[model samples]
Target: MTAPTPAAGAPDRAAPPGRPDGTERARGIRGVQPVAPLLGVLALGVCLVTSLDVVTAAVALGIEVALLPLLRIPPRTLLLRTSPVLVAVPLTAISIALYGRPSGRHWFDLGPAHVTDGSLTLALATALRVLAVGLPAVVLFIRVDPTDLADGLAQLLRLPARFVLGALAAVRMMTLLGEDWRQLGMARRARGVADTGRLRRGATMAFALLVLALRRATTLAVAMESRGFGAPGRRTWARTARFAGPEWAMVGVLVGIGVVSISVAVCAGTWRA
Candidate 1:
């Protein structure tokens, strides 16, 4: 197996990464279990309330925002995690604005695309809903190491141990994907084959990365099997993943936010089917 390389633009490992505030907060919340279940509950609530309840969506988003400061998530890390929403939410909202169920006063029309009060309302709700659903999961997971997460899943969730560990190993290699890509680019440049069409170069690099990943996966599997990993039997966890009071409180808070938001929307007569 090739030695692993650091990602080209990753921060140096001189000291532990993460902001002081975030690291401190992580200490308090680090070893909890049922992390996925909490996030799933929040996501399900967002889906139920977002379609025709703009007020509920907005309230839920506000609750999530408030929780961010409590979590002490640094701005840089938060930005990195939530950047996908910046692109995806707008595109999704635009599509809804242009082609959603038309009602109320018409705003504009272009070919098959049309905008109206109802669609514009839906667009705003959709954007808020995405933020409400996505931000919490990202913030919560920023401190979760993949190996620990897999352990939690296998133990608390009673998932297959071998599969969970294997998936965890794959996730741990994600940073290597970037490192490998950078190395490949450098190698190509050295061979005087770098100055090619951008699309073609990208395709070649991607294919090489895929092959590298497959090789690494094979090596990893062999190593694990050699250590009695795939044997069907009970396994012991080095660290216990407990879903105690704090974890339950966290889940309850999120559920309460969803319930309260929906109730308020219903009372305000803004809750639509």
Candidate 2:
């Protein structure tokens, strides 16, 4: 008996060979249109809390945490993605406490590096504010596909088509560089290269990767130019990027969070700046 083939233009029954399906990619707020405005809001929030306002930072962080469920980002995935920032926050706080400008009552004196009440407060505020700002940005950007970001930049922001497409291409290549580096290491191992002399081997591998990257970049530039990327004619987008009510609403929600946080801090007399 002959099996039936998929009809022309019909959706495939199976997922692509190695790529995740749309469901996996669509977990969070999965578009760049909303992210653009959300980013602006976060930037403004960063500025508002830059004066070491601990109460404001805490409130903003609480609000951001409350909104996390709406983004549909898995807690484990989010932690893994933002682990660097999470680790750095404490280290930064410690540095600020140890070496920051001295003010208020002295807490500890270690020669030139002194810890004061003001320095400690500033350190806590700095760490919390970084979390408040960085967490949301990380979560939002994870859901944004490079193609969607390119579309949003070109369509919504009116950026030059060539620049946006070039950025997209570069971002796509970076994701593969890790695998390429791993393969290069494996090749060296198979060739019986001794792992002694770390500096020499690292320099050689880096030079090889640089040469490969330059060649790939040259090829990409040629291909893009051949397709009339930098031409003077009016260009059209393959996908529509909308900045509509939903995008505006997301920005408004973020703005409200910032305002409420500041107001609470001010009323409670914790807003030092």
lDDT of 1 by residue, 1-273 (tens): 998988999976654443444352233354555465455556546554545668978988887777678777789988988898777899989999999989999989999988999899999988888777777756677776676677678888888998898888888888798889999999999999999788999999999999999999999899999998988777887667777777777777777877877888888998876
State each model's CA lDDT, in order.
Answer: 0.78, 0.79
- On a 0 to 100 scale, what is the lDDT of residue 214 in model 2? 93
- Across 131-201, the per-residue lDDT of candidate 2 in tens digits comes to 88887777777776777777777888788898989999999899878887888899998888837778888
Estimated TM-score per prediction? 0.81, 0.83
Off by over 4 Å in 1: 1-30, 34-51, 188-203
Q: Compute the lDDT for candidate 1.
A: 0.78
